[model samples]
Target chain A: MKRLVVMALVGLGLALGIAAADTPTTIRRDGVVLTIPQEKRAEVIGDRLRCLVCQNETVENSQAGLAKQFRGIIRRRVVKGETNQQIIDFMVHRYGIFVLLKPPLIPLTWLLWFSPAIALALGLLVLLLARRRRQQGPPPLSPDEHDRLKELLS
Target chain B: MATMLTRRLMFGLPLVAVAAGGVASYALLERMGRGTYNPQAFNNPLVGHKVPDFSLPGHDGHAGFDQAAIMAQKRPLLVNFFASWCVPCVEEAPYLDAIAKSGLDIWGIAYQDKAAALDLYLAKNGDPYRRLASDAEGRVAINWGVYGVPESFLIAPGGEVRWHTAGPLFPEIIEDQLKPALQRLT
Candidate 1:
């Protein structure tokens, strides 16, 4: 009975440890506590937004004071039940599309999205045309040249 | 005939592609150059929007900002975001002082700076702000969508942001861009 009780206690401790591991740590911002899910949503949104001050770093990765405050703003909005699009739109409205790390597919960005594909297609077409020309073997060397080659061999 | 056409296309197509690529890249580069330094050419999202209201602690022995009272003055307000740590802010101080003396209602919001340092800087350089507000955590400046210091906004009587300029204000910029905007506001 003593051994059984010890095994049961050990199992319970292991189960508790697993449960603790599953729960994400919460972050406090401006006196508001963000739950794990809320924090995750904020992080996802933050990762998509650029830190305007740092220029190259995303809001999620930047340690700039502005980025921290931006994260806090995201968390606050998340806690308030704003959708991801709503948060993004709010940021874009204030900071312009430059704030988005991955800008949406729009008319302005059409060249950016399609230029590489167009270039690749053009390159492949050129290669195929060149290969076909090479396979044709120099236009059969012309009929007169063929006859001249045959007489020389004879 | 087909081979001749194919050969011609093989040479012509690449030239056309190169020309197109050159033009496209030039256009893109020009656009990027314009977007970086020319804030006026690119539309500022904050322009025409109502300025966000903020009240922060006062520095340099002035009372804190009161947005309602500022709007109550019924004149165009020039809100300058500066910091004691920012070198451009120091360089632009005399221009701000000159603008203030010219009878424009100018106010300052100290961005992410301590009061003591701000006071020392103001004492040495000359305090140009009529009423100075301290943004210790920089929340107020963030609300204004200010990414850099030495940014100024000209607010219309009803609190609409008429014009905003980034970087230190030069005398020419004041005369060329700022003065014209202020004139339109009045």
Candidate 2:
């Protein structure tokens, strides 16, 4: 009887979960369904974008009102049928490149983005050079071992 | 031999487990942090979108209300989501009252608080909200993406949310940001 109750509960839980998952999400405007899942894509893009007010925070993570406002703006544009590039352009114009958490691939920001890889390579090169130098140096020989070897050779 | 093997296992086992656990935790945190804001979460700005359906009791309880109708008013509606306990809401009360007096169609939703307390609050602070709705259970707040109290949304004539403000709507943001959206809609 206990097993049957647990099974029934599990089944009920699954049904509720499925029902909640099946909730319709459609963006409709002026009686016409936008049909395109632009909001989903906009969220993905916004999350990648940074919040300028809190420089370290991405639009997704920061609860700063500005981030929320920007997310709303992005959503509005997407619903208005703007492309991703156009939305990005709008943000860049308004907030400047500082709004993007992931710095864009530009001449000025190339160093900011690629400095970590360069530093890593330099560190590895230094380690390799030090290791080679140590390897090329004469091996340490204990006094007793050296004396024994010298005596045997004589 | 068994003792030596046991000693090695004792040291190696914990090290492996710790390393595995550390790596797993790091990966999980990275994955979690990766879900930063994306545009998709907010694709529909209230232009022509069906207003988010929410029914809540009024401050009087005698007159219940729906958000869609208030939002679909001929004049643009300013919906402020506030809680009696929210400090920011208290701070912004004067500004809101002023804005409403200026003939802006301002409405308030008392988010997740008692209607009685809200009425008392308005009596004390000055009623800025022309019509107040009671969201005692926070259902309406969730549908509107309200994380905190004192958030505001400006709804256009078509019952779409035109502008959203997460915190206290300062004079500048209202003047610069919100005014533009309202003008465009009108």
Best by DockQ: 1
Local accuracy of candidate 1 as per-residue lDDT tens digits, A1-154: 9999999999999999999998768867644699878878888999999898788899989988788888888888899999999999888877778888997899999999999999999999999988997888855578999999999999
Q: All candidates' lDDT scores?
A: 0.84, 0.72
In the range B88-163, model 1's lDDT, one tens digit per residue, is 8888899999999999978888998987888889888898788888888887777777877888999888788889
Global Cα lDDT for candidate 1: 0.84
Model 2, which residues run further than 4 Å from truth? A1-154, B1-49, B61-63
lDDT of 2: 0.72
Chain A TM-score compared with the true chain A, each model in order: 0.75, 0.59
List DockQ, one per candidate, in order.
Answer: 0.38, 0.02
Residue B115 in candidate 1, Cα distance off native in Å? 2.3
Give a tens-digit lDDT track for model 2, residues B5-91.
979998999999999999988877774454322222232233345566778777784354695677558888888888888887888
Model 1 / residue B30 / CA error / Å: 14
Candidate 1, superposed: residue stretches over 4 Å from native: A1-25, A29-32, A114-154, B1-43
Candidate 1 residue A152 Cα shift, in angstroms, is 17
